[model samples]
Target: MIQNIINQNAYTALDQEEYQRRYDSLVERFDTTKADLELTTEQIKDKITRHRNLEIFLGELKNQGNLITKFDPLLWNSLVDYATVFEKQKVEINFNSGITIAVK
Candidate 1:
């Protein structure tokens, strides 16, 4: 939409004061600025979702104050997204919040 406006006004924008002002405003900015904003917005939303999930995970963890000697199925199901077993005694654990840990 904005690009369309810029394109349609390109002809009359030349040799005009308002157009020159508009051009000057855009001169300091890159055409890809919109894409940059979209990327960062996605990142921020992902981070927010992860943080909320982490909060729930932490709340459940707070119940286990002492050292956890036994495995908790609830914690595992809540925190783990998936696990992949590899050759040579290696396993990769993927968390629900986009984090991975490898164990050997």
Candidate 2:
């Protein structure tokens, strides 16, 4: 959009004062849009990194065989961040990549 606006040379068709106002507004909008795009890109990269890390952790856990059969410190430390016990009926397991699973 910014490139198209610049290529059109639309601002020059207006009077000096109007052209200045329009140009400034367009530039401001372009800057704001650019910043928003950069922020979105950064967020996407962070999500991808977190997903990759989770995959690697899962792979490591898979190599250890059945987790429910025995209590292994290394596997627990790598896969589960923490556990929340709710009364006597429910438990919440928080995984390393911010996923929580509830067991009842």
Candidate 3:
């Protein structure tokens, strides 16, 4: 029964290897997703700060009675376009196992 025992041990070792591989892959994916989320959060915070600064500028211009003239419509339109693009952006990752994950 030593041969049978050897075969069983080999099977167990292969199974353990497979499990480790899957676990490692999952950990890698989790780390990547976490990093992506952190980057996204930073981007959002930056956008908020930019919007706040814009508001402050507008308020100052209003105090000077130059709100309309000092604000270039073209520039404002471009900023709006950029914000729209950012808001509409979607990040999708597809795995070999036919699994798809999206972050927006």
Candidate 4:
């Protein structure tokens, strides 16, 4: 939509009202697209940050020991800051380093 506007040659105004109407419509479309792009960019950045944090958390967990073993309080303390046990036997663990993992 905005591409078609860009392709058009500079406006030579035959009537003042018509020229103003076209110019305003173009500006409105550009503003809407710009706002949408900003929002999408922010969402992408948030996902990238979460992914990086998850990678770091996994690295720390791997360095600790085998995950399948019996629960070790010391290892849990080293990695997790705190945890919340919710209804339905769900648990949300907040790691001291950076990420949160929910389990059931």
Candidate 5:
């Protein structure tokens, strides 16, 4: 889209200033739109990586049998990433599967 706008053929116009104004406006739009596209593409790629990590983690968990009755340090290490504690007893626990839980 940006390239097509930039490479478009131009014909003689009665108003040269008007043509320049429109062309400059298109150039500005092209820059901003290209930046936005790049940002969104990176976000999508990150989400895809996060999702695959979650799928693999869950599959391993599913094969580990029934509920656990004892404290398992290895399991805990595999599941939790880090935790954030805020004021007033508010805490956020981040998991290995890109999920977070807030406790208040």
Candidate 6:
């Protein structure tokens, strides 16, 4: 009876240790994942800001009539290239207020 009690206690202790180890590992992974998510969020925000600035620059260039007939083709090509690259790496942000912004 005492031996049975000893065996049960040992088994319980081993099980508890294993559970603690697994729990610790899970918590560490969660922390790492949270950090990665935060970094990604910041990067997306930066991309949106860059896109907004580019739009403003494009508008200014247009207003200044920098795209004459001779320069139109080159300007169009450059715009197309920019659009393609932006589309390829586009980020979509959906806010809690049900607003969606596409940054490309």
lDDT score for candidate 2 against the true structure: 0.80
Worst 10 residues of 4 by lDDT: 4-13
Residue 86, model 3: Cα distance from true site in angstroms: 35
What alpha-carbon RMSD in Å does predicted model 3 have with respect to the real structure?
A: 14.8
Tens-place lDDT digits, model 5, residues 1-104? 44544445343433657656777888899899999999999999988977877776677678778887778676676678899999999999998777899999
For 1-104, candidate 4 gives per-residue lDDT tens digits of: 44554445255325656655776898898899999999999999978977776676677678867654678665566667789999999999997656799999
Candidate 5 has a TM-score of: 0.61
Instruction: Kindly report which residue pairs in candidate 2 clash with one another.
Output: none
What shift in Å separates residue 2 of candidate 5 from its native position after superposition?
Answer: 6.7
lDDT of 3 at 91: 60
Better of 1 and 3 by TM-score: 1
For model 1, the local distance difference test gives 0.82
Estimate, for each residue in 1-104, the C-alpha lDDT of model 1 and write its tens digit. 44654775775545467765676667546557877899999999999988988898998889889877889999898899999999999999998978899999
The best candidate in terms of lDDT: 1
**Residue 45 displacement in candidate 5 (angstroms):** 1.1
Provide TM-scores for the models.
Answer: 0.62, 0.58, 0.50, 0.56, 0.61, 0.50
Compared with the true structure, what per-residue lDDT tens digits does model 3 show for residues 32-67? 999999999999997787777667655655666543
- Could you say which candidate leads in TM-score? 1
Q: Rank the candidates by TM-score, best first.
A: 1, 5, 2, 4, 3, 6
For model 2, residues 1-104, the per-residue Cα lDDT tens digits are 54655655655464667656767898999899999999999999989978887787778777877656878787677778899999989999998788899999
Model 2 stretches with alpha carbons more than 4 Å out: 1-14, 68-95, 99-104
lDDT on C-alpha atoms for all candidate structures: 0.82, 0.80, 0.60, 0.74, 0.77, 0.61
Q: After superposition, how far is residue 9 of candidate 3 from its true place, in Å?
A: 16
What TM value does model 2 have? Answer: 0.58
- How much lDDT does candidate 3 score? 0.60
